[model samples]
Target: MINLQWQSFSKEECAKKLRTDIAKGLSQQQAASRLRTAGPNELAKPKKKKLLVRFFAQFCDFLVIMLLTAAGISFAVSFYRHSSDYIDSIIILAIVIINAIIGVVQESRAENAIEALQKLSSPCARVVRGGKEYAVPAEKLVPGDIVILKTGNLVPADIRLTESSSLQVEESALTGESIPSSKKAETVFPPATPFSDCRNMLFS
Candidate 1:
């Protein structure tokens, strides 16, 4: 439990403090109280998007559409000209189709990559709220709550250790270590640093 007698701090303030103090030994109750808490401890959700809408957004490319229109004009001119123009019209149409196909393929693949990246960040969390267990959406998680983590669950957010009995965490996602890490509460810094040693004190 977090002995969070945080007399002066509001929940948001307290959560902010906890995020800043992830490695700085805060008690379980203190940390728990801040878990999935509101205030400064949250990242707001983005507006939900429909896949068809997103795909349509890609169609707005002026260059691709322009090429297609030009090709259509080319076909119209050839048909009005003479039967001998068939080869020229076909070539123009092929160019337009190829350009459109390339644009659609690349843009669609890029969107998929972005979606896959989002999956990497969406992790499941086990939390204790009001002395009861709750499985919640990670985006809805706030600070000032007690979170229980174990093998097979992704670390939804950053955490400070309130209690640990040989807390071993697999940090290969962040640290590039095939071997898992053992966690303990302590101060750490430069969070984005690629140096594995700096990440020793905390888990995701």
Candidate 2:
């Protein structure tokens, strides 16, 4: 993992450590190598349950388990007595199966909706490589790569600003602040400083 303590270093120091030019950014070959080493810059999606597993999980609830146990016992008693009361047991089993199916359908729909929203929210980024700028999917970014940002562009990853000219960012997505925070490129803050106060760093 990349230590964010790099934020405490000067732009020149960071460039020296990352072995990239702040002015020209990383060459295409260097960016490709770093991508293999650092992996992509993307948010981790929540793990989802398989459809059959999710459907079965509904029976794991305490109330549902008890209902099943009751149904089983009722079924046994009706079988022993040879009474029409066995129809009641059948009805109970049917109700439980129907309820489980409904739960599964609802949860599957919800998961699909969440997945759609995640796809819609995927961010794109602008980066400089080999002295040329390219617009690429944000998930392809890697550490040591130089990114260019403008107003309304989402910060694709944790970044230590190398240059700033009248840069201001709305960090309410992470900090819950309602105002746009002013940014600076030259200042190095203490490592223990809170995120809301790190004017020299930008976060994804």
What range of 10 consecutive residues in model 2 has the weakest lDDT sum?
Answer: 1-10
Tens digit of lDDT per residue, candidate 1, span 1-204?
A: 234333233333444765533333334455445553443334565765565565556546787577667766877787777645666657766766565567667767887799799868666666675556767667555555557777577677665555556667777877787998775533334435443454323444
- The worst-scoring run of ten residues by lDDT in candidate 1 lies at 1-10
lDDT of 1: 0.57
Model 1: number of clashes? 23
Please, what is the whole-model Cα lDDT of each candidate in the order they appear?
0.57, 0.84
lDDT of 2 by residue, 4-31 (tens): 5776789898888888887778888888
Candidate 2 segments exceeding 4 Å error:
60-73, 76-84
Q: Which residue pairs clash within candidate 2? A: none
Model 2 residue 125 distance off true place after TM-score fit, in angstroms: 0.6
Top candidate, metric TM-score: 2
